[model samples]
Target: MSENETQAEVGTTRRGWTASKVLIAVVLTAVVTFGMTALLVNILERRTESAQPNHNVVELSDTTYDPAVWGQNYPQQYESYLRTEEMGLTVYGGSQPIELTPSETDPRSVGSSSRLEDDPRLRIMWAGYAFAKGYTHARGHEWMLEDQRYTVRVLDFNQPGTCLNCHASMPEVYDELGNGDREAGFDTVNAMTYSEATQHASGPVACIDCHDPDTMSLRITRPAFVTGIAALKASEGIEDYDVNRDATTDEMRSYVCAQCHVEYYFDGDAGNRLTFPWAEGNHIDDIWKYYEEDGHIDFEHEITGASILKAQHPEFEIWSQGVHADAGVSCADCHMSYDRSAAQKVTDHHINSPLFDANASCGTCHSDDAETLVNRVVTLQDRFVVSRNQAFDALVSLIYNIEEGMANGVDEDSLDLAREYQNKASFYLDFVYSENSYGFHAPDYTQSVLIDSMDASRMGELALEGASREDLEASEVTQKYAQDIEDRSDLEFLR
Candidate 1:
């Protein structure tokens, strides 16, 4: 009896031991699984933190115009912003500091003996304008103030305070003007002479231009941009629109850049007030119409007495016509590509062409590698340059013919008509010349504008002289340009 009872108790004890072991194993497995997951999560969090920039150094003031002051708070952003001083030139465009000595001042010495001299034709095209004094490619934001200050165009002091609108830290100038009140500084600065305004000029395009200090949010600080955005909205029939209040975040990404990278003129009636001619539209022809309707001319040509308009770098307007804008890509998307450093991701403040950092800029979206993307951009630029040269040639010939007619005692009435054509031709040509993108922003739109310029120039030549359109078109330059245009005509447009 004792053996049977002992055996039953041992079997039950064995079963209980087995069940306990199984339970213990299940609990241990659960614990290990949970521990591994926690460890993995912790590693990921550290990696994320390592990749992000998280500096909170200082409280930036609303009136802070010094990039150094802003840099103290956002070191990564400030460091990148400082990169704008890097002046590496590409084939069609980028930045190169030009030195104009006393010897290089002669208009005839351009592009021949002087490395910095622009094309010889620019001298005649911009005759009677400040540009004829000097023209150079724009560099980074760091050089904005320095370049404008040293340019021969500013030596005579003929330009007004409005000229500093794009070149200097407007906020710094405004602070001085408004006695520390940035809001009031704008109007005060606008009323000053170029000589006086430059006294307060600060280096580079600063943070205050595009950011709100209190919140550090991207904002439009320039008064002209505020007005221009409103006008742009009004033209689009968007009622009650205000940039400060109504613009979307994506819109601001592009709008903030539109502040300086646009076409503008100084008002004659309002003491040369900085103005965007978007009163009509942003299209090339639209601006042309704006000048005619407003009877605004940048300068009266010395030789032909033609009142001509100078096209500023209208990157924003031209980009608006491109595929990037259509696809909702903002200027900052390419130019100010997001950068990662020290566990921080900030918008690259380099503010340069996409070509500068193709991988980060174009590679983010483009399936093509950097080399292919660059080649594509170069191809577009090459097409633009060919047409651009042809337009230049036609305009130069037209200028010569008009001058000849004026000298030959062409009737005042006919000369006036010819002058009008000259204005159109010059505007068309200058539109291409001043644009920094080399028509890559809107290839189709660029070609159309150039063709118009070429046609108008030829017409002006014909009007001044008895030469037929066919005769004008038969030139080697025109023939070569026409063929290039034709070849690109069928190619799919980026816009």
Candidate 2:
């Protein structure tokens, strides 16, 4: 009776074990099958994404002045574009956010640090000009319009609508002013007062300024740049050259930026028409020659009593002379490097110095690590600063000498000659100084300009010591073009 009971219990135990094995096998098989299905689904989804094109959610046109509108169709780019509002500093450039005590005159509670306060010499350099009244470190694209509106230069002084050309989105304003004719609108706006012209602008620079809405391709929209580039090409013996038509995609990448970044002046004779003095060429020497022939003087120095020329930011001109330009590297290549967003690759819209993200920006071309690339940039900048400071000091000394000479009753003719020298030295120094790159754009070229500036200052000092005009004459090239200097006495400062 015991054997039969034991055998029955053993058989029951074996059946229980076999049933547990079957249950475990079923669970394992189900888990593996589920994992494989999930992987297959992910692969299919990615493949579909790769094959599909970007779907436009909304129609865009010339009048689309709001970046947010463009963002609807290109969310990845728009998201990056919004980052321009994020303020931070690099080694030598980029804006540092500072707290501003909001006042009745300026409602801004935040702003970039003041370049004038950082270096008082700038005030002296720009004295008798609106820039002396206000000059601050530049913020990103998002702040372009607001910063221009609130700056003391615009607040206390009179400026033409030309100032708004680069600071704000001009397409809508141009359309409104010219009754749908952008060029005609550009002309009318340039003639209006800054306060008046600014009323027409809807916002700061937007996608419309740089892109063709239908095709999403880069195009030049600024009239000043259009004419300027044409003049430059004509000088190079290319007749009727048109930037929008002639420039390649790579060239357009840089040209779009050059529209606002180069040196410019207002043509007062033509209703204060905003103009780029690119008729001669884009180099500093070419620009000086063009100004000499045009006889354009920015202002008369309050302290030195010399006709002074103020240089706007000349990034494009400087960059054109740099090695990177020779290598065919466009501004977008570094500042707006391409990035992968899910299945799509798009240009980053957070426009800032490449140093901020060297890996994404410089690492594309250079094999070096991010830190090394950044360090290289800083090193170039450090050398530039050293040279710039020396040239600046010399120019300041010349200014003081001219002032002292005037006060001490130096001969009128001698003082006049000294003043002329001061003008040359001042302009040359200002050209390099106002450049945002701090000379990193063209190190050797910048240094050469500084050397000429120092030489000009020395000549001015010699002139103060009663040196004859012949003794203080400039280079052969300058001497040859001496008679071309135009009389701008009748011209009024448009500021």
Candidate 3:
């Protein structure tokens, strides 16, 4: 009886069901298509952004990064850096600031006595710079931040922002602010007005010290290094940083740190840029050749301003000339040695000398009692002491003569020659003292370096004798270095 109505209702129901199925398919297809597009866009965006900067750097929120987060980001380096704070083992490189054998009392059997006691000679040579005020051999990474603060306080009261160049986690400074800090906008930190960078400065150093947070890969974040290297490269007729770039793991270790801890000079250019004179080369004689041999340097032997070549902590550079660096042992490889224990795995922050982890360090290469390796360094250190004392004698005498010459009308002409001696003597002394006999990282290299230090000191005395006092007085170059001891009596530099 209701056949027609039943047929019509069935067809309508069937049509409704077909429409619902079509809608469902369209919605599912749209969702999936959108999802794929979003994913591709994300991947492409990352690629495009990274393409602009040859190095894809990631930023770390220093204020927010936790130990776990850091471990995830940089298991090797993060853990390694943390180990820098440990206080185990010998003082190795740890700070005994309060009890550090007073410089004068330090054993003269090794170069430590020269490094500590005779630091006053540097005060005279560097009258216009901070070193004249005071400088000490570094203890470890822990002291970096502390040293920065202490140095700033002890140096010029009118010091500019350039003071932050090597100490603080300056990458954070440059990022939080712009690159207008001392390393960027400087000819002199004491020039113009002092920067207000103190408020923005962070700790001595941290993960950002040698890494780009984004990629957790090593990168040079200091502008002084970038610009300094450029000046050096340009002077040497090189164009790319790739020339000095490390291609392997070993070289990168020390080279990464050398990117900052290097000798540098400020240019008289517009920015008075902090420049590294590495263009000619990175050796003692090589850098000297560029500074003096080429006749490109400024020299005015004024009591307050001496045409100068500052020697930075060439730990890496010196290490490079040593057996460990030659063998491809990096600074990280030794200084930041790792260990696995029973319950929890821990990377130490109490980093000091590799002596603390002798097995982890020297053991990786030569298998021997650490005492044997340390003894080699001590023996070399002992042999070098004779030369160190000699160099100290020569430097002290030359500095005194430089003062007397000014009084006797001898003139400041020979001061540059005097400085060359100073530079070499310093390098030799540095290598000897920095070898960390306890670390056993580079015993052979340490031995050879002490010998070199002794030789350089003798050579310095010879150079001082050869230069004319007349020439020193006449060469009143752009920058003048102090030559008179009596005139500088009140300078408040080291005693």
Candidate 4:
């Protein structure tokens, strides 16, 4: 063939190739568009399904204690709630039971090489209080009533009726006491003895605690929460704040959990009235100051003789300062996220640490995969463990130092400041120690708290060595606080 014939043939081949490519691209585009449209439709369908409330079962009473009654109407949520009975352990959180033994040489050490070990310092710190007798690892919400009934802290110690505030189906008790008058019910129940209150616990934490029966709109049932939140708002300069009226839907998601999972105390003078010490700010220091200025000592330290304060579960308070809260995430956002597939969508009421269901909990907001998020969480917890242990070691040393100074004939006046240091130091350390998060909830805040705790512990130790209050207050830990260096033979140290 000639050169012109060859060029014409080559041009024809090129044109044919271009035509084939265009046809393939059109087919691929149609498939991609169809897939995207289907995905969008499915998402919208799930949203609509979840948005519509469950309306299948019978009507429930406002004061229903049995979750099964609520379960009848909301089977998915109720069934998920039952999973709290599962004793499965996550990496850092969960109520997987671990055996703890009081150390043979040191009864104060509650952990026998397990995380369940109650810091030995806790015994010293909570001395003369019921917690000193019995404190255990916190379990799931299902055990709220069970734990309360059986703990030595309750049985051995004389807990008032106010103890029932968070552990029982409080709505039912309220109804029984006030003849269905919720407000009047609170006053009546508040006056009951612990034994009388025990008779009132119908079941575990139930739907009525956080919901309005007629509408199923979230409502605060506990009277303490109503007053506590009002006080909290007042502290923030909001007058006459009513939770049922003032709280936004987004705020209700968190406010519901905050009802129970917050720091509280029994107001001994006025009929053991359950109180949230939020008249001050929610910070560790703020609460401490409130306790100090108000002369609200939980117990006198039997060993150090310092009037000490006890912290309850303050998850909501501490978490309120974290990045998640700042970014508008609620407790329910992670703990009660919706689990939707092609068929159904509803909130998973299996309330737990977000670490348990990373895909639904963390992955919902995070771009990372579940495994990455889990690992990231584990790393954060590990950091807290190191800091917490450091603080713990320092605290134990301080306790021993104070005891030693007392044994060596240190004057009560000079050692009085040491006792004061021990009081503040242990409170700081125990605040983090008792909180269930292990520091995953608020990493930066957790670290700063632990750092201050370590500083206080070392200061207490130095005060035992004749360090002045000014020096103790200004001093910082330049080295590792000593650990497990206590003399076991000393009578005061043994106590």
The candidate that achieves the highest TM-score relative to the unseen native structure: 2
- RMSD of every prediction: 20.8, 18.4, 19.8, 19.7
Q: TM-score for each prediction?
A: 0.79, 0.85, 0.62, 0.80
lDDT (Cα, 0-100) at 168 in candidate 4:
75
Candidate 4 per-residue lDDT, tens place, 118-228, comes to 465566667678777777666667656656765667667777788887877777778878898977877777778777886866666778788888887898887788898
Could you say which candidate leads in lDDT?
2
Question: Which run of 10 residues does model 2 get worst, by summed lDDT?
Answer: 9-18
Q: What is the lDDT of candidate 3?
A: 0.50
Per-candidate Cα lDDT values, in order, are 0.75, 0.83, 0.50, 0.74
lDDT by residue for model 1 (1-495), tens: 243543343233211124664675457546655766666566557757665333333446675455665675677788888767555677767765333332433221111122126577888888787787777777677656655655667775377778888887677678778897865777767778777887777455788888988887888878888888788778888766679899888989999889999989888787777889886779888888888899988888977788888898999999999889999999988898885433345788987778866888987788898888889999999999899989999888888888888788877766676778789988987887788899998999999999999888867766666544454446646684566766675567821
Model 4: pairs clashing at backbone N, Cα or C within 3 Å: 111-117
Residue 206's C-alpha lDDT in candidate 4?
75
Model 3 ranges off by over 4 Å: 1-83, 86-93, 99-129, 152-155, 179-195, 227-239, 242-246, 293-306, 340-350, 405-495
Which runs in model 2 stand beyond 4 Å of their true positions?
Answer: 1-48, 51-53, 340-343, 474-495
Clash counts for the predictions, in order: 7, 0, 34, 1
**357, model 3: CA deviation in Å?**
2.3
Residue 340 CA error for candidate 3 (Å)? Answer: 7.2
lDDT of 2: 0.83
Q: Model 3, range 65-95, lDDT digits (tens) per residue?
A: 2232344434554556544433333433434
